[model samples]
Target: MEKNLAQKYNHKDVEEGRYDEWVKKGYFTAGDKSKDPFTIVIPPPNVTGILHIGHAWDNTLQDIISRYKRMQGYDMLYLPGMDHAGIATQARVDARLKSEGISRYDIGREKFLERAWQWKEEYAATIRKQWAKLGNSLDYSRERFTMDEGFNDAVRHVFVTLYNEGLIYRGWRIINWDPEARTALSNIEVYYQDDPGKMYYFDYKVEETNEYFTVATTRPETMFGDVCVVVNPEDERFSHLVGKHAVNPANGEAIPIIADSYVDVEFGTGAMKCTPAHDPNDFAIAERHGLEKPICMNPDGTMNALSGEYEGMDRYECRDKLVERIKEEGNLIKIEDITHNVAHSERTHCVIEPYLSEQWFVKMKPLAEDVLKNQNDPDQRINFYPERFSRVFEQWLENIEDWCISRQLWWG
Candidate 1:
């Protein structure tokens, strides 16, 4: 022990020598069956990352707990790892490629993925070296990457099992789609911006009756996809209008005027346009009322062939054209200036469209039920740090919906 100590207290020399000795002695290794096991699985950080303060804080806390357990005569297995960070890593590589006057599409998916793995290897080594600098007692030998073959197999098995149990399904549903990524993102992956907007009120002529009723909408461009105009069933003024059909001002398509409880009578016009293929709430109303879902826009935010004359136009461009067309046709009742929040893609910073696409989803209700049960149990295995976090967990589990898991990106 005296010989191991350096005459001069040099951190670099002393620490490196000790770490090398520890590694050589297999002190940070695991797989011994002769002791009480205490395992700690690392919350893998994104590989497309630099060691930051947050990473240091998290790893320090984990290391503290792991070391305390080890001192208590437990066989500690604090496994270290990093995630491939699918979308994030791809975005970074794409940006890098763009700087070199090239794009991921130029090299194709296979070549792009090769570059991604190369980037992974380079940064992962940096992350590991940075983690080692902290001298955390981690089992480096048991390191796992999210995209590793064993991890990939585990993920596939779980997905297949869920699918077999009917917990996983595919359907054409309205999702927050990132036009740039060309992928459907989950609700949590989207951020919203509050901006000024106008609510356009247009007259929809009742087919059965010659009388015209005004329906207010924020998106006039999506009118081409409108399948029904809904009103509160309890509203006496529009109760008589139920079972009637109205002509869409944009394309002159005869759409049903249905009455449902989903309509907010206090809101604008007390009438909501049901564009099942575009709006999530409207999609739900359409499903409840059995309405046809006619998509007006493509995945890339361009109007599709179903949009009549507005076809082949960008959504914003179509909005301008539709407004002018509606004004010319004498269907424009009034336009009220309003402010609203719109969802945007977290990665692309592009306006996210509530697009209808066939994608895989996992039923979250059952999973939430299990989580809630575990949370509420008196002898719960996991405990939240702050007691109030338990309530937040409960609230999240209570209001969970089906999670969209599939993305239209080649990276993952």
Candidate 2:
């Protein structure tokens, strides 16, 4: 007599049990190196998150390919892994510590990293359990983590080789800085949002005369760092003011008035205040005119001593107070409501500051050139899906900028 089958398959009863049995027998592991080989490397997931639907879907796709290869009698190696996640994980741990009324600086970098590792270990086990429920045949015995000693060693070797080949170097440049995290971030890590703010028009008085020229800015707080006032070389109204100097409103320091064709005649006031240490375009202008870069804010986004009486105030706080000071001094012409895109940190949600810092960068033009050349070869070695993506990809490579690689966080 045939036994009656259960009315319904119970996931709670069989899922973990079946996965445990498969792992016990090493069915997911590669054996018999002589067999035809098939391998799929799992995209490492950040340790800061748990098993989400997106990860379940991705692993399911990898499982299909792995299972198909196994059915064809090939030795399959589907390796699973997780990343230390660097800034993201560090930020998570920081939030946790803050909830407990402690700080990373309270315990020091070594102890802070110990907490991060503990977090990783606890979360990793939960991730493996969730992954097991999905029934993906990953090689559990060979699972890897990016911060593992073996992986770290491999990374170091690659870095040293690139450095020896002159592909890596350090230089001072404008970077997106997260004031809350107190670290420099890559361009991709910043989120830009359209924000409603005011554009301020202020007058810069000629050092030795009653003459004053109007300039406009979104961030009046950066006026403390202004080293020069720039006008278009052909702007007839201000051509006579070129090569003279103007007195800074925030401080009594005298700054040069330079003429450059890079100025936009139609923009507010037809004159631009050049804050070399605070803005990228201003930095370029300073470079062309050989002016000094005076940093006005600390890494934590507070005004520094260079900002005169406004030192120790928060950046936004200083902006409001500085505007009031300008009004009292009769240098403020007007304020206009404006909507502009402002960058914010993706992790901390604080506004990003255009900071001039020395950071390690990789020159990208050489690498982009190789990719562009290879894609256009007659042999057609690389192909693009949807065909239209080829043009977009080419344009991106053509205009690629130097990549910032260093992060100031304690985690990997």
Candidate 3:
């Protein structure tokens, strides 16, 4: 029977029920044992929020490839999943609690986890609905979540295997710390921004001598923890002062004046304070010179007992007070306004501190070596789109640092 053509296309009439029909017919399922298999695991979206334009675009691309493979007679498996998004989900949950005049601590761990699971289910359902609406040919029968029982078991097995292989270990090292979250963060989690700040110049009086060596720093509050002043070993300007002691202007403590090539002679006043616990470079120097790494700030970014009179004060507040005290003591050389790249927490937008901490890390160099070898093997190489990105991937692997995988969050 011939039917009259509609004046305008109605997308709802044309597309509605079409996806359900395909699903019921098992069109997206991969069950032919004799056929060649082609599979794509969708990059899981965070189960913390609703879908956005980006998710639509990404899923559309995956759908196109999956459909093409299916048409090519391959048993295509378009697997779907959602991520528990540890830090991101926790941050959102924390904000929601804050808006309610309550906190995760007030509700306690178990109750907080219940809330997180509720959030996860709500968003996961929304995500599934969005994916179905997009007409993606996903294998719903094989759907998974990152925190599912099988997935959790797989993750535990992998972690245990790595730990047994000596590729995973816990040790004291300098790491990015989110004070607001009270947790250690990986380097990639830190965002760098250029901020207007100051370069403070102060003097370290030579112990039992009439001379003083001018020192400069951006974080004067950490001076209370400084164990030594470092100068370039090749710099004749401070060569004679090596092995001598200098009185700390902030605490009246005698700290050694040491020399190491790591000190940049052109930077600041050709001298740098060794606050090992507060800085990564200083930590390395301390290890080499056998200096003490005293911590000056608590986990919450407040001055610790090591700061004496400034203890319990916020770090920035202590900085202002300590600078004022230094000026009054006649040790302030100068203060220059400047701009510098400061590390900040990507999630909380708070300033990140390079804190000494004990945390688990995955050794990356060995893994990188194996990956590079595989890339060079023609039979095993994974081709990169545009081809030029292969070099970028290789460069990243070559210079990759140890990855910190453990997060201090209740979820995931």
lDDT of 1 by residue, 303-388 (tens): 99988887899999999899998899899989999999989888878888898899999999998899788876779735888978
Query: lDDT per model, in order?
Result: 0.87, 0.89, 0.91
Of candidates 2 and 1, the better by TM-score: 2
CA shift of 321, model 3, Å: 2.2
Q: Which scores greater on lDDT, model 1 or model 3?
A: 3
The digit string of per-residue lDDT tens for model 2 on 116-235 reads: 999999889888988888998999888999989998899889778878888888999889999888899988899999999999998888876769888899998998888888999999
Candidate closer to the true structure by TM-score (higher is better), 2 or 3: 2
What TM-score would each prediction reach against the true structure?
A: 0.86, 0.96, 0.92
Q: Model 3 misses residue 71 by how many Å?
A: 4.0
- Candidate numbers, best lDDT first, in rank order: 3, 2, 1
* Residue 105 of model 3, lDDT score: 88
